[model samples]
Target: MTDSTATRATKPFRFGVVAPLTTDLPTWRDRVRRIAGSGYSTLLMPDVPKWQPAPAPTLAAAAGLADLRVGTWVYASPLRPAWSTAWEAHSLSVLTDGRFEMGIGTGRPGIEDELRELGLPVTRPGERLAQVRETVTRLRELDGPDLHTPVVMAVRGPKARALAAEFADTVTFALMPGDDRAEMTRLVRDFRTDRDVELSQHVAVVGDSVAPFMASPDTDPAALRAADSLAVLPDDPAAAAEEIQRRREEIGFSYFVFGADFAEKLAPVVAELAGH
Candidate 1:
């Protein structure tokens, strides 16, 4: 058997879709099929309130349709018990036959409101990250038929990134080429002792006009500073397609996760890269 470490290190180049939770299943399925047909192999469904489906049931509903791998973009670590999340993820892995990848992070902003609405307590982030670590460790210990998935950590800060390298199969971040990008990569590499751990990266793309539409002159300097190599491409679909492809290659992520609306436009771009 290939060592788990080697297997992770050697996983193939992947293209994945980030399915927003609120999208209808029929729409999502159609998208997934198109994505699979377009040569992408993975799907990253976000676990936020509006994005989350009934995990196992939703996954089951989409099961066996295409040659695609699927997993959570992230589940809110601070909101639920480590044991509960661990078991839930494990069960999903079993149901999906090892196609699941777990992305976890400290709860996001406004989580308090969401939890209260769902009748849950709102806790602090540091405590939740710690709890999540313990739960992930325990889940990693399970073997045999109960096991099939790999847990990943999505972190931005240095300390959390280091911790993820030590425990998770993959350590990922929302990276756009900037001081933070260089710093994040450096931290991950410095702390990552094993060749086995995978580094997953995220990048956002927008047409050249997007700079005007999405970014304001007063947007936080820290956020803007974080997006250094962030490109401003032409508004035309073809030009946007080319620009997205270029950005993906420049970023060097193991997977390229395209937004839903960009799927059709990104098809030729993805094909161009694959051919290379």
Candidate 2:
């Protein structure tokens, strides 16, 4: 391992919860407060349109209700123009008093179909990556020299990883339900060989329950365990904390993001490990 990767485990640990507004305003505010009170560092909203409210306004509301940071689980680049996305991100950063982290990516799987449905151009992979780049560039320009809004990038392919290495403050290796753990470790190791950015992993399952929208509803916990998937965590707080530390030591992952449904389940682990 390179020197940077070797020392990666020494990075402080922080936790985030991905939550969308699925209830009344009061209920959502309560959830946001509870998440902050539970020792979470950030509250994130997914970029899915129609199925949920827009991420910007929701995140603004969330940030207002709690002292915790706020961000997008990831903004899909193809959803809107780069300037528009960057403008909203810059506004959020300013409104939140620099507490907003911009999480962005080309888009999720099958984004082509979504684009087609919305009558937006269905660009190729390279074009989508360009969009991400443009959005980040525009965001930087808008933020000016006085402020730097942190960027969190969720990446999967080599090209995306390269772009993330260039611009991301935090990087998340987008994992599928059954992706090989060894390969992921190698990828992360390679990514960290020269840079010391914070590494985040999205936890889809805590114990036997899979968080909604994180994975298929029928996703089998036994199957994931048998495959040694990194997307699942133990239910017991002590066990979960142990595994999280092991992951940081072995794979250089120090930041963990959990879906809202199981954020409470992992709060104990968060309470024990956050800021450590």
Candidate 3:
């Protein structure tokens, strides 16, 4: 089975889309079919209640649809018990034939409504990060000693970033349009560990339309380009290659994710950066 170690050793500068389940089954199936051959390395969906479909079923559907790797953009650790969350993740890992990469994090702000709905406590960052620690440990145990389930830790703080460095195969940061190279370098430095961990940047690629859905509302594609945050090119393959080089040399980001708006537009960039 492909584990975290193997993934980090082999996977190159990869690209993925966090496609939302905003449409009906037939339409979603057609979209999935298109994305399966779009040169993306992974197919991920966010676990925001009511904002997107239930993560497990949606990810399982993606697994059934194609050979592309599947995972949650991240499931909030505090939302479900470690065992239950691990059970679902474990089942998906098996179902997807080791194509599952479990991305998890402490629940974000404004999760109080969801917590209230789920009868979960709205704990502080420390307790939530502890939940993340327990969750990753349980997932590994659930996957068994022989088969390691690749894990991704999405975090931004020192303590949570520490959890990611220790337990994850990849770590994703929600960078803003105004964030400079120095800040990004600092974040990578903070997230670095002796173990291999691919650093991922979730950038909003603008083509058809900017995804209003983003970690930060300020991630508008036009605004980002204006602010010098947009590095990869969607139309020019050479420019895309240049962006890939810059990412690797400047800050060591090997994985990049975009919203569904870039699904079709990201093809050229993905084709250019898929293997290299």
Measured by TM-score, the strongest candidate is 2
User: How are the candidates ranked when ordered by lDDT, highest leading?
Assistant: 2, 3, 1
Q: Tens-digit lDDT track for model 2 on 175-269?
A: 87677689789878767445668889999888999887677788888898888989889988899999999999888889899999887888889
The sequence of per-residue lDDT tens digits that candidate 1 reaches over residues 98-165 is 87777788755557888888887677767767877877876776535556477778776656765676
In order of appearance, the predictions have TM-scores of 0.74, 0.96, 0.87
**240, model 1: CA deviation in Å?**
7.6
lDDT, model 3, position 100: 90
Model 3 residue 29 CA deviation in Å: 1.2
Which residue runs of candidate 1 sit more than 4 Å off their true CA positions?
A: 1-12, 21-24, 50-52, 144-148, 175-191, 208-252, 274-276
lDDT of 1 at 213: 16
lDDT of 2 at 16: 92
Minimal lDDT window, size 10, model 1:
208-217
Of the two candidates 1 and 2, the one with more favorable TM-score, higher being better, is: 2
Which pairs of residues collide in candidate 3?
Answer: none
